[model samples]
Target: MMKFKVLFLLTIIGLVTCSVNAQRGVRIGYIDTEYILQNVPEYKEASSQLDKKVQQWKTEIETKLNAIEQKKKELDNESVLLTKELYDERYEDITFEEAEVLDYQQKRFGPEGDLMIQKRQLIEPIQDQIFAAVQEIAETKSYDFVFDKSADVVMLYSAERYDMSEQVLRTITRTSKRSQAKSKKERQELEDEEVVPVVSADKDERQQALEDRKASREEQLAAKREEREKAAEERKQAQQDLRDAKKKEAEERRQKVIDERNARSGSTSNEAKTVESDSTAKAKSIVKADSVKVQGTVKKDSVNSKMPKTAAEIAAEERAQKLKDREARQKELEARKQKIIDQRKKAREERERQVKKNDSIAKAKKNEDNN
Candidate 1:
């Protein structure tokens, strides 16, 4: 039968080729029926259901066969004690069971059996779909002849350009999609939906929509990253400004203390000079007044005049106290600045750590969603 088909195909090809020069050339195409069947969802589902039925039938047959075998074994074991008539009855029953099992197997698996009938029924609709698609394509594309590559007719060489399997599959898919609708209105809606291009496998609307969604998500992620970077930069700038402000305040305080120290030093120098001038004038007075009584009076007056030296000492003590106070204030200011810096540093680190945690969480969620 296969050789006959091949010979017929060759004859047709030769005739078509001979007529091409005298008439319009035949536009020939081929499709793989097997490929079409594999791609059809309804067909695959029906095939699965049919396979399950076949398995169940096989199991039933096996169970009956096992029962028959067990009965035979029992009959053999008990034959020595049984009477001839009883033994004959038992053997006859066993034979009947075996015959019944054979009939069941024939009924289930024979060429004209239920399995074949149901399988044919299941495939008839799919075959109709393929035929309808092929007819439509032939009419639309003005094909003179269309062949099934998966059929018994063997072709040693067929060009890929002449393969219409994908187009047929697409057409069948559209038909199945329409038929699946519960109502005429829904069917119409499905029919009105955009048809995928036959030549372009990547032109599926759902896949395109998925790619669009992916692109949108990536853009959103990029925007979020930009926002994070901007916020981090702003935070860093704020920290720097805070540090500058603290430094300026501390510098101002230090300069003020230095000015106060210089003022005190100048005043102390003036007081010392005044004390020295008074002592010199008093010495001159002591030399001028030479009597014992006058000399004693001068000594007492000079002692009274020496009070400025004590005042200068007091001024020196006050300057020392002020210097100590200034040093304490400076130390306190430095500590406060350092504390603020530390606090800000910790805050920035905490924020960055939290951002990282959030990023990790978001990434995990995204991965989960993808899975």
Candidate 2:
């Protein structure tokens, strides 16, 4: 209830704010920050670099922890035979290493840590540029108010046309392209005079080696990421194909079973139809014979002597006809009910077969996996 109340108040406040903005003739627009970030190459590169570093750091941490665990196990196993002095030294060494690992983990992953600082440094410039680009777009478009749809602003509805992210991205992209072109032109002018590439000739060999190692590390990280993604995609496609094959096989088996059942029932239906036809023909023959016998027993002026049918007699014939119609309808209903029942039975059987097939497939897969 408290949450609901808070939400209600917030909604009311938002409505009032929008209403005030509208009364002041303000135009509103929104931008998706996440979308803009996705479009920014520098942001992606930074993120990938961060991810690589994080992975490396995590691996280092795990390796250190595992080493400590192994040493502890060995010390425990040999403790009974070892002298107290030696045992204490080994245990002290393990504790020191464990402390070092914990310190390193905290340095990499704790709040206000090296990784956090590096990440902030990496993204701060990009974020500033994005904000500047957004500002420029807002100014040129004469937008009175712009909101970030990606932010924690509550949005019950948003229209696509009001989005200004594309505008911001376009502005940023143009600036980057111009910067690149200017740099390239400068490099070309230098190259036209046959100037050699700058190789930091004054730098120490150690510094140069460090820079070289950093470049190689980045390249390896990029290559590994690409390979991993490619392998993952291939695995996904293979799994999809396997699933499709299984589904196709299941469907074909079910269809074949239904077809065979229908064929068998078709013969029975044909025989029933033949028997009904014979019964109908026999019934018609008997009626004809009775009519002839009645005609032979009647006088020649029987029609003339007979009175016309009264309303009650006509109504009686109509009632008889209605009863016969109702009986025919009941028979049709029964037939339809029987068909539905048969269909349900067939469906249940098919489901059971499918379940059995799935169980067999699962069992086979488990066996394969175990092997």
Candidate 3:
């Protein structure tokens, strides 16, 4: 019985030990990719240099496009001055020139511009190197999956404990430096191969031809520089002419506005003068009428003064005049009030008629349904 109890206790202890091992097998880790990208000097330099080259290419293409546009404009203008026969002959030449310009533009700026593009294509391999380093660190550290906390998918990660970005970045930088040195050595060896020994007549002739070609190229470059400067000056003059034309047009518009304002002011002044003359004539007529009324009043006063003067007559006259004015005002107010009351009654009747008409139509509809 004691042996049986000892065996059962050992089995229980073994089961607990297995459970603890299973729990300990689980692994999790995180890496901050953004931190690595920001901290890595090589990555920063490569990205900045690539951006600068791209900008330079863009500016060169823009200048070429502007030159082509100017040539097209010149060709268009020349076509107007040429005879029909000459125009037809020149048409093919101009078309060929335009095509050549376009082809050159595409060659220099298109997908196959330079070997630098192939160098840029190697960025994927560099990225792969970093990823491989990360994988190595993850596997060596026994991490099941290394999540990037900078990707924002991992809500919480202990910075010191979870980060493997520094390790990966250091590994990548060291590998890239070694690869770059090796590539440079290889390039130097290739460049050395291009140097030929000047022993044969054929080699001497080739060397002379090369020197002549280089001299011719230098002369062509100088001519091109002069042409570019002349073209720049022409463009500046054309821009200045455009500005002057616009300024002249603006001045003409300003003068036109001033002339219109002057005409309007003149018309307004004439209207004011006419109004003043009409007002003077009206004032003269009013003065004449006042004089006539005053003369009539003077005659009546002289007649009344010669006849009689009495206080009771004046009092009766004022009383009668006041009564008449009061009755006239009262009658006007009563007429206005009655007119408003009649309008309101008409509106009420019209509303009632409309309501009745609607009710009759509804009743007819209900009757028709019942039938």
Candidate 4:
């Protein structure tokens, strides 16, 4: 009967253990202390103030050192004229000044110095607040263990789902707001303020947030790409329009030149001038012969081809010949322009070389004179 009772007691204990195990499971989370510190405005302000102090101390030290350096330079320059006793006194003064500056630097910034002390003083309260926030979050979220990711404890691999840094920052913000409230009305207002709900370590929620951020980034990229494409298209259209306008202007100029040539030919037609004096006609013949000789050198084949063609055909042939001559003249002009540019480039290079040679000669002579 005693054995049976003992077995019943052991079975009851085992059942209670199984019930407890089923009721609870370990839920671990961690906060990044460095991230928390960066988000805390009070800590940031304190750090900025400390940095200013450090800068001021560094400037002071630099000024003293510069003064010492200037004194040493002056002492070296005047050493030949100075008495031994006076030189020793100035040297001692500079040495002592340097030592003082170094000591001041150490006092302000050394390991056991004011800088470290002020940093600890500024950060301790912030750390306490963080600890309280972390504790509150852990308790409220039913977290079995909460670790500091930025602490000395090494975390080789940590999942993003377990990060609670944002919650800690929110808690800090709320606490600060509550502390700043000076009246019941302000407290009520702060309490009524719409705050973002703290996200727990739910995989679905974290995944959704990540996806939202990714979608937002992609949208921004798409907007920027669309803007770029629009700008590029505008630039391309503007360039094409400019090219078309230039081509139209060139065609107009060519047509105007052809019309002027046709008008001149008609005015100087054989059917019009039948009343010129003999000498004037002779002079005209002389000028015409000279011009024909010049034209013969350029055009081996004459436009006055002896093919019994119609007036319209002759005019078309002449116009075509004129166009070819104009194009040849343009080519010759471009070649001359290129030749002139090359000559100028060569002349410039020669001038530069001559100037360098003269400078070298002058430098050599000056050095010889100095020696």
Q: What's each prediction's TM-score?
A: 0.45, 0.43, 0.34, 0.48
Instruction: Using lDDT as the measure, name the better of candidate 2 and candidate 3.
Output: 2
Q: How much is the lDDT of residue 45 in candidate 4? A: 95
Better of 1 and 3 by TM-score: 1
Order of models, best TM-score first: 4, 1, 2, 3
Q: Give the runs in model 3 whose Cα sits over 4 Å from its true position.
A: 1-22, 29-38, 84-116, 147-163, 173-371
**Model 3 agreement with the true structure over 1-371: per-residue lDDT tens digits:** 99999999999999999997576565566767767766677667777777787677678767766776776777679987888988776667667766776776676567786535644564566567768877776666556777777675946437474567777776676655555655777657544643333333345447879999999999999999999999999999998797677657755765676577557656755665575567557656655665565565556666687667578546645654555565566556556655755675576567657756765686577557535
Best by TM-score: 4
lDDT of each: 0.77, 0.75, 0.67, 0.78
lDDT by residue (1-371, candidate 1, tens digit) is 99999999999999988886346445789999999999898889989999999999999999989998998999899999999999999899899989988988989899998999998999898899899999988877667799999999899999897899998998888877776779988887777753443332233435768988999999999999999999999999998797677657755765675577557656755665575567546544543443343455446557667665566555655655565565566556556655765675576567657756765686577557535
Top-down lDDT ranking: 4, 1, 2, 3
Best by lDDT: 4
Residue range 251-331, candidate 4, lDDT tens digits: 576567557755664564322333223434654565566456557633533454654567766565576566567556655
lDDT computed for candidate 4 = 0.78
Inter-residue clash pairs, candidate 1: none
Off by over 4 Å in 4: 1-23, 188-371
- Error of model 2, residue 270, in angstroms: 36
